[model samples]
Target: MKYIFATFLLLNTFHLFGQESAPINHELSFQFDNDLLFFDAGDRYYTNGLFFTYRQKIKEDRSWSNLFGFQSLHKSIFHVAFVSKIFNPYNLKGEKAEEIDRPYAGELYVDGLYTSYWGQNRLAVGVDLGWLGTKTRSDDIQTNLHTTFGWVRPRGWRDYQIHDTPIAHLYTGLSREIVSIGPLSLISDVDVRVGTINTNAAAAITMRLGRSQPLDASVLTHARTGERIANDRKCKELFFVTKTQLMHVFYDATIEGNIIGEPSPFVKSAEPWVWMQSVGVMLSMKTFDLQALWSFLGREVVGGRPHKYGTLVIAKRF
Candidate 1:
């Protein structure tokens, strides 16, 4: 498994390293992808996931656009991040106790934006909504877990390895370009979400290195605090990208990752914090765009044996 993951990363890195100069603009785009991963058996299984995305602008202010996407994770095994020993069996029913497989589920969402309404200063808002294809098992497992972690858990919910449950979300956030100091341009992506039968807020900033082949870096912070519709927690995300164009050859590479709070029953015990990371490169020629991405997701650490996952994704847009 380790070798396979290493090889996938190397292959994707080489593929993306070759394509560094690509320009993004106003146009309608559609993308579809399938991703697969294998975990140890007797306690684990593999996942076959699929995704589809569409994005376009309502008009051409070069400032307004919208995105709609769907993602499905089928035949996948979820990890158990926490352990509960003192909870009531009735309360623990249908909770995150061990790893389990879900056949398939769909996620649908849409986001819209309106930038620079008046002049130099700009603003944008976004929203997302979707449902997991299945629902939790209504049994003793759920009740038992809930009783044990009712206080320590971020949300008043137990960690559960759930399947076929609905997953829906909504987000509204804004951003502004505050400074342009020489070769550096600073921008922000901030938003608030009210869904999951709760509410949460998140924000991130981007600092562009104008002279360095249009490279840019960013950091994001998200939290769920108070009783206003979200939970109470905090996390950080980092991102960086660079692109170079030499006549007909163009290449670009981007890396992004996040340290997020894990509230799900599956990962309740391993640690309240988890990490998700991805790196990608794209090469373009005229109207053709070719790209490859390597991603790592799941708990940041697991006892003496850390659990890590990786994927190689290829995509094209025109």
Candidate 2:
């Protein structure tokens, strides 16, 4: 952990010193998921997890743009970030947990993206590198600790040799404003991801209704890579936003294990389709932003049950 933090600090320092004159924005946010919202007694697939993300953006029009030749490439902005998350599966909880064989896991991801805008439309392309699964003995220890603290009875020890894998993927997404009527505007977004390990595609349409003058188009889209800091000085706004998204996955290595190998105990026959419907309200001011969303998720496998989760995001901009 120390090494990871040091590396992050080093990269941040480099970017800060190298782009001293560029307008930079930094945002940090957390996401928590639990099955209690769905009135379930025990945690199962997609159980409790906490995700943390740090995002930093550098404006392309600044002096650092010359160093990166971004203008020459027609890119409007550069973004780099890191994400870390710890998630536990069904086996980590309860006395009857042995029925489910999934193991607790940790995920570390690093991504960089370039974005460009044309009128009300925006495009982003990025590459993500992820390390999924337990990295060391300490990871398992921490998982046990977290489970214990959460009031789950800890299973003494178990085999986790089948875990640990690396993932590399490339993704591109587009966001566009479709129409506007009075203070309501409709925005559409599409994201596609393909990699050696997993492949998925998703699309969403959102409706934003509020004071038109303070609503920033960027806030209506769900793609975090495409999000941008509003440049206008008057940033106070409140918007009621609702979005529905559908996603289909050709493959998910995480659930099914590696694509090339024999299946693990946790592997189930892959289910390629899923859907999510979300409704959220966002409040943005000059210095901070807050959004609360409730989402309903469809079954990921043939016999699986649908679930619901809530997400709250709070971000401070500097």
Candidate 3:
């Protein structure tokens, strides 16, 4: 319901920035991303996604985080993360001068945080050992983006989830500390994917709207059922986004959906529902976040076919 007034004012505004009265401090940072105008639904692509995050708090509860990621396409990273799914089961073919190593999708996490005696908000429990090369990687950005629905990919990059079976996974997450206005801060998180889709679910709502207020908004939603595409089981998505950080630097727009039954080839059982839209902009730099997007699909309720487009993403996160 419109995120219930920004998730109840971001849970009482995280009790005022999850305060600790200022004292325990330690910092580390690293981020790099470059999609350079990429699109998956229509399959017009370009990707260079590299994410590395490491954080250690060791005292205020406990924390350990490590995530090293890589993806490459006309700019290869094993043909953009190598895929087939469930994890992987040998499916790598090469071309364009060879060196196609088959599998690797990094992920490692250890966590424990409960800082709310008035620290504001904190409650976490984690564990996720990973590998699932791309083919949508089940569509990331935290898997739940609502505008209509989710899951879209036409060819190479939609590889059954890294090639169908390579397991060693575990996940659990719950984070809440919603509400911070005036530089804008609102966060909500939920994750439970455990041992690979028994009842997968993910949710996130974040609004940090302020770098001098150009405008920022985020919404992600996800649900699961086997991973679809053969009888088209079940999948859900909604990613309504709004970004404009101080006159450009990065601008965005999104609305996507896909639901099916009568053997969806892109939904046309008389059309269950398929919608897409993307806008663009990126030119300054808070940390260089570029942008570009144009996508297609509509068949009743909004109509369709305008060029069947694609292109969006140009990243740099320092």
For each candidate, the alpha-carbon lDDT, in order, equals 0.28, 0.58, 0.27
Tens digits of per-residue lDDT, candidate 3, 1-318, equal 345334333432322122323321221122222222333332211122332222222232222221211121000000011112211111222221122111122122222221111122323334333333332344443233212465332222232222322234344555444675555555565655444312244455544333321111111111011011222212121222332211110100001111111121211112233333434332322222223434333432123222333333322221
Give per-residue CA lDDT, model 2, range 50-126, as digits (tens).
55555545454466533434333422555566655543444544334344444444566777776655556667788
List the candidates' TM-scores in order: 0.38, 0.72, 0.22
Which numbered prediction scores highest in TM-score against the true structure? 2
Shift in Å, residue 245, candidate 3 = 17
lDDT of 1 by residue, 14-93 (tens): 22222224322222222222232323211111112223332221332222122211122111111111111111111212
lDDT of 2 at 186: 84
- Which pairs clash in model 2? none
Measured over all alpha carbons after superposition, the RMSD of each candidate to the real structure, in angstroms, is 17.5, 6.6, 19.9
Rank ordering of all candidates by TM-score, starting from the highest: 2, 1, 3
For residue 228, model 2's alpha carbon misses the true position, in angstroms, by: 12
